[model samples]
Target: MATMEWIAACREELYALREELHRCPELSHQEYRTSALIEKQLRAWGIPVLDFHLETGVVAKISGGHSGKLLVLREDIDALPIQENTGLPFSSQVSGVCHACGHDIHTTALLGAARLLSEHRDQLHGDVLLVFQCAEESFDGAASMLAHGIFSAQTPNAVVGFHCAPQLQVGKVEISAGIREASCDSLTLTVVGKGGHGAHPDECIDPVVMSAGLLMQLQTLVSRRNKATDPVVLTFGEIHGGSAPNVIPDQVLLRGTLRTFDNRVRMAHLAALEDLCTGFCRALGGTCTVTVEKSLPPLINSPDICQQLLTSAQTVLGEDCLGSESAPSMGSDDFSCMLEACGNHGAQYLVGTGLENDPATRMGLHVAENIFPSQAIEPAAATLVQFALDYLN
Candidate 1:
């Protein structure tokens, strides 16, 4: 079968694989079953998997009949800590864990591409590396795999990967030139104060009050300190403190994230956040300690690689399916780590897997009601295959 015909023929198998993965979702760094399934599938296709040190990641290589450039195609295989409410028959059977971010689709699509590439390897020229990476949700699985030198001897000429985008319609793909994703830095703030009765307003140095002030102050780093064009977002999603209504806690813990497009801006924001939080707590007669856990860098796509992938996408999915120059999001991915490790020659594209054009039916990533269309698997696989073929040629 030809490229398109082959992808079409394997749609059922791809869907079944995706559903199986969805039903049996696994968390980051704990994807033993997921990794084993990928290993089994790749080995069945006669591909040679390199040695992997990470517990839940797998890396396999497929070489054509002749020698040429190397290409790496990666897929993240992990589920989020979300209970499924999608009401689908294949919904997560594993309680409190679901493939809400569509990693299931990503895994199945890459598996489909693997099958097609293995079948068409006779017509190919160069080597293709399939990386079924793990723990992309909260853990930096990509970086973990790289730290073990998974690709020390098999560096690729170019790399390509994909993510599921709910906003765009099915069969569509989006490719951006630079800063595809923002840099992510996690923040932990501890406010220490004297504990007393909540009713006694002036008797105790309330850390809860200090934490509230700190949260409000941090927002200014984005709104007042940073330039409008810089695009900075600081959001605190978790705060834990007091026990009872009348009891004032001795300490309050704040957890949040910092996202920025530019590295300089990211650093500046982190510095300002620490300084401001410390100052605020000190002025309010409380002590504060700010801990910043640095994560992946911004995912900036190489313009030359984007152009090549765009051409491949247009050819495979038609011109109408191509989305470019769209607004970049504040969302971050550990794929940035993969790109950096791959010599910064890779591009991660967004594949629209929404079931319909209507917004109501479209599901957002990490939401409890995520319903990624199974239809997108074939198109995504086809585009990725085309990208590899074109790059190798």
Candidate 2:
């Protein structure tokens, strides 16, 4: 923190930018305004921008007059579909769209680093790619950009990304040497049954009842079937069935997600879930259709790259500001796609953004009550700038 006095002096501007971005939060592929703003800012700073095939993403490059190794610095710019309730002065103006996951902060920090690095380009030894990615909330934004030939121009030697961590206080960072986040896959189960009038006793095979039973049975997949030592999280967040009180619906839809670390465990869980859903519905004289949408894979950090980042982090922010070990999480991220696309030459870390000594201001990501302090912008932005400089040099 002491090594970034320059970033401290620019904190006010970064905070204002963060607030400005927070107010106009956009969801997934709909970050048109956000992308335009980022591109405009980079261009204004004399940095060259790339007009990628994406609808709402910007890829910019900064060369230090001599290119050696290319380093990619990524910051996801998409917000969630949640509504704002933080009551901040710069709360989201868009209804039913909020930056609950702190993408606003991530975007601001990247912009800040861009400005700082541009100012000191003469001191850089290589090229830096700024990836303001969109639709990260959709789990396919990175792939979209890649499909549009994001890497067709030049493959990066290393890719680095950061996410705001509310669990840790501002001025701290967590770098993982192994798996940081779990793989995610969504499952939609459609249970079909006979529709009937409420007065009928045996005329209908009730889907609502079968769905309820299936939900209970699905809970056992993790607890009973999977090994206790293995980690897996199965959550059913959406379930819809009949609409009327007197009539039973023919089909009930169940939407849920499965998160796991190991590939074998993830595949086994999917197979088990499909089998259980099908078997339960068939035995009940009904039919079930299961559809699985594959999402992000488990985010695994490259040990060598993480070690380099660890050393750089300790030098820039001090030892106390860097955690010894990152706590594994069931939460998943599409940044894993970037690492996989880069051929395992990339890594990610968490930048603490929670307020210090203010428990009331600290909350988990993607929650309605989540809110972070603006002062956190300085440390986060400074860390990004320093990391880029360290890696490039």
Best by TM-score: 1
Clashes of each: 0, 0
Query: How well does candidate 1 score on lDDT at residue 392?
Result: 86
> Tens digit of lDDT per residue, candidate 1, span 1-393?
456778988777888888888899999989999999888888888878788666888888888877899999998999999998988889899999998888889999999898888877876799998989888887478878888888788777777999988877788899888888899998899999999988895999999888888888888888889999888888899999989999989999999999988889988888888889888999999999989774778889999988988888888788888854567778899988888888888899989877655553376888898788788887789889999888888
Query: What's the distance in Å from true for residue 124, model 2?
Result: 3.6
> For each candidate, what is the lDDT?
0.86, 0.86
Q: Per-candidate TM vs. native?
A: 0.91, 0.91
- Candidate 2 lDDT over residue span 81-163, tens digit each: 89878888899999999999999988998998888888888888898888999888888888898888887778888899888
Weakest lDDT window of 10 consecutive positions for candidate 1:
354-363
